[model samples]
Target chain A: MWETVLSALMDPVNALFLVGGVAGGIVVGALPGLTATMALALMLPFTFSMSPEPALIMLGGIYIGAIYGGSISAILINTPGTPSSIATTFDGYPMTRQGKPEQALVTAAFSSGIGGVLGGLTLLFLSPALADLALQFGPPEFFWVAIFGLTIIATLSAGSLLKGMIGGCLGLMLSTVGIAPIGGESRFTFGFSPLQGGLDLVVMLIGLFCIPEVLAMVDRKRVAKQGLALKREKGVAGGVIKKLVRQPLLLLRSSIVGIITGIIPGAGGNIASLLSYDLAVRFDKKHKDYGKGRMEGVVASEASNNAEVGGSLVPLLSLGIPGAAPAAVLMGALLIQGITPGPDLYTRYPDLVYTFIIAFIIANFVMFVMAFYGARYVARMIDLPADVLLPMIVMLTVIGSFAIRNSYLDVCMMLGFGIAGYFLKKVGFEPGPIVLGIILGPIAETGLAQSMLLGQAEGGVWQIFFTRPITLVLIVLSLISLLSAVYIQTSRAGWKAGRRDAETCDAD
Target chain B: MRRRLNREIGVSLFFLGIAVIAFIQVEGLNRMSAVFPRTLAVILLVLSGILLVQSLVRPPEKKKGETPLASSRILPFLLILVLYAVLIAGLGFLIATILFAGVGTWYLCDRNKIRAIIGSILLGILFYALFRFVFLVPFPGI
Candidate 1:
């Protein structure tokens, strides 16, 4: 593969796509209201002229670059450029307000690069093994997987587990509005034909994530504002670089989370980032500082999301199942080229596949080099006035949502979701669980219904779902997650009470 | 009852209402299609019940907190956004965007009328160029 690949790699057009794809991806990703999915969709037309290898490589580059690019807006403006970057805004925006935007961006770049490389390496070396692992998953297993993801709500909501659960239920219910995965029946349409397609994830994402923040910014008073000026530090973000380099465990842990999440079809970086962020909070002594300008928060999210880029490819290459939204677009690109991707693809086009994988790894390097230096200039978005930034963001979001399916209904849905999300956030509901629930609802429902049918043939539903080896393991993991969340919440309450008693004793 | 009310109780009741609505909607669907949504609706009811019980047993102690955003200032802007979305259907993308951007900026921009005017017009053109020419997004009136 490498022998024939050297000449293909040397091709000028491939080189341009590799570099330009990443750069263009980053720019699109950095803008508010834009996402990597939109970037890839727009780039689809350009791929018709190119050969299969270059087309796949260009889409791969864009996929990598755009996912990473989302962090820039997430950090500086409190808007995630993509759904995966939702966790990035948790700490990234706070760091920006605290005058450490430069450090946050640098941390994101390094962690994302490491995660991307690790994911790429996994694709290069472990795809065959991982793809085979993916085959073990059926509807029942996927149901457990979605349930396992939902358990993250326990730890995901540091405020109130009850509210998180309720929010998750709301998202799950929203997901059921469209056609049933197996029954071929529509439940919630109430005679409206447009809704038979259900709610678009991108529409909900824009509404629930971006809309609330813009409204809050409009309502917020200047007295509540922190350090408004962007900080310019010395070389390589000065001390922040050393601090990040020291936390190799955090990088590796977060990347592994991304990689694993990516391997599972339907589970994307959005879940990975949230899961790793939960893990970081669960393990750290200063877990309380997580949503409040923690560098570890940005690193955890960016690393995991980027690593997921690599992880998402595993399923696509192996089974033809797309692991994430962008990966779904890449699958379309492959099909358009008349190249069907699956197990047969490995034996059929070894050189083309191998070269593209190698090129994907190199694209991550280019992303780091470009994003690291380019971040400072990008961070200058802070210098733009709220008046200018505010309306512009809304405009971009309108265009972004509209571009998805060229429909006004999506734009309306976005506004509706944003308004609902704003009120929901005020009442202790975090978007992570709700979004997770939405993402998992389809998978969970499809799995449950299909497994029930399988169970009828195999003897019983319990035997089909609970008796399987993989199903049993997932059940245990879900139980552990639930128990851990309860323990953490109780312990935190006790700690606060104990400190209050100590203070009272001191006063006496 | 009003005095005992809190965000927890409010949210709980709201979700409980949703669950009830879901139960009503599941009537026409068959066993398979009804099962999942029905299950989710039950879960929502159970969680909301727990929350309601928890709040009733012991309401949270009120603490001084940061000022919440005033809806008076926020609602108008939110309405404007809805208006923007509505106008896109009638007036098309170009006209709707320019009006929304200019008016939204003017409303938020510390009263810099000239800047708002310039920014909105330029933004409209910029968005038009990017989406229409470069991306080839075929939104009506683009």
Candidate 2:
């Protein structure tokens, strides 16, 4: 592993690609509406022809860079470039407004690098052990794991539980459109040949997230504004280092939150960022400064979100289940390279895996350097005119949509989803749940059915789930998560009611 | 009051109708068909029922204001996409891309005619050169 890592570092071409990928990823990520997933999807054709090591390295660079790039917009403008950056805006914009934009940028870079390095190290050491344990899992255990992922419905639901469940069910129904998993039977093709393959997840994501956003932007006549001008400081490096030393615990706690959330298959960087930000607020001695521009908030959000990249890959490498949407796309890229993920991945391609881990560490380092030097220029993107930016994005989206498989059907799908997304948003349905559902739905279904079939051959459904200790443990955990979500919602409602009653009494 | 109730009822009826249609489709499938779709359809039916009931119980949130200009602006964009799709098969990637980029820039950006034309032509050539010379993507032909 050490030799592989050494060789990867020594290889000039690999290093060059890593730098290029990080740079490109940062540019792509800094652009609003150009998601990391879209960047990977657009780059898929290019990566198809490259060697597996360089390809994986490039993709890894993009993943890390894009995750960090989102903070640029979050800090400069109020809009988060990616969903994961939503929490960053809480403190990032406030910092910008306080004329500490450079300080915020430096803090973001430092925390992002620290979190990323920690996550990469976790992947390096823990993956082998996790892979070994994963070797014991069969269809039954996998089914339970998928069920556990579905249990995230409890956490994701913002409104009525029933509505969330209904939305999830709708997502499941959409997934059933292509073909039957068990047999080769075409179930819901509706006689259209394109429907045979069902809706592509990338198309679904682009439609659900991007289309609605573009429509909203057009509606509001939204224009990008020049960010708060700050005095050019020479000591950004010194400032970042000083803050790192001062907020060691905050960085550590946020990184841990990011890692744990990333390890969970359904909870991606978005959730990790939010969870870390919430914790930072709770832990801070001066909580009043939280939404009003605290450096701790910036550290917590950026560090945790970047850490999720490492966390998400753990499941992808060990279990063949992706930890997030972009990870799912990465998994697809891996499959295209003829590299199947699971226990065999460790045994068969130890060197490549090692190379990937080393490259991830290198990618974070590259991002740190880029962010340090390029912060001035990247910050300027916040002021780009929407009229110019939107058209360019639309052009790219069209080209990307068409480029996949060179199919016009995909173009049509993109446009259709764009319109559908616009309406869904207007109706108050969040696309986050929908995107999660689309990605996870097929995996959950396939696992459940296969496990049930195997169980019936053995004895019964209950025996199948209960017999395996690991499955039992996962099942129990899922129930606990569901219960906890319900408890939180109930307590929140109670608190709100109490506050309302007190206000009423005071008024009277 | 009547208008609001009418809209809710219409939405509910539409979903219920789709559920019925889905159920009928499922019934037509052979017994050998997997249990998953049938199960999914049944779930959808139940969901549609719930959505229907909810619509009746609670008035839909009244959305404020007119639709965004982008929704209307999308038609021209869609036409450009359609043109690219149709022409790409015949003209090949390079020509189709050039045409798409050129026309799309002019139509969507709202730039002056000369600027639009120049911008489109430059974008086309740039994409062509990058994909062909740099990335070796093999755009079809002239």
Best by DockQ: 1
Candidate 2 chain B minimal-lDDT segment of 10 residues: B61-70
Give the docking tier of candidate 1: medium
lDDT of 2 by residue, A334-441 (tens): 866888777668888888888998899879999999988786777666565554555445445555555445566776687677776665554444555566566566
Model 2 Cα lDDT, one tens digit per residue, B17-114: 75566667666554434565667667667766776787778866554464432366666665665666577668876667667666765664565567
Best by lDDT: 1
**Tens-digit per-residue lDDT, B24-141, candidate 1:** 9997788889889999988888998998898888776554463343467787787888889888888999999999988888888776899889989999989888777865766644
Task: List clash counts for every candidate, in order.
Answer: 0, 1
- Give the range of the ten consecutive residues with the poorest summed lDDT in model 1 chain A: A221-230
- Assess each model's interface with DockQ, reporting 2 decimals per model: 0.51, 0.32
Q: Tell me the TM-score of each prediction against the true structure.
A: 0.73, 0.86
Q: What is the lDDT of residue A13 in candidate 1?
A: 82
Q: How do the residues A1-508 of candidate 1 rate in per-residue lDDT, one tens digit apiece?
A: 6788888888888988899989878876775545676577556645655688788888899999989988988887787877789889888988988977888889999899999999999999888775566567888887887787677554445467777778878889998987898888887888889999988765666566566666766766221222134456678465777898899999999999999878755456777887788788888899878777999999999999999999989867875655665676677578657787666677788788888999999999999998888875654542445677667667766765666677778778877887888778766776556665676688789889999999988888658888889889989977876776677567546645754674576579
| Residue runs of model 1 more than 4 Å from their true location after superposition | A1-112, A123-128, A154-158, A221-360, A484-508, B1-4, B60-70, B140-142
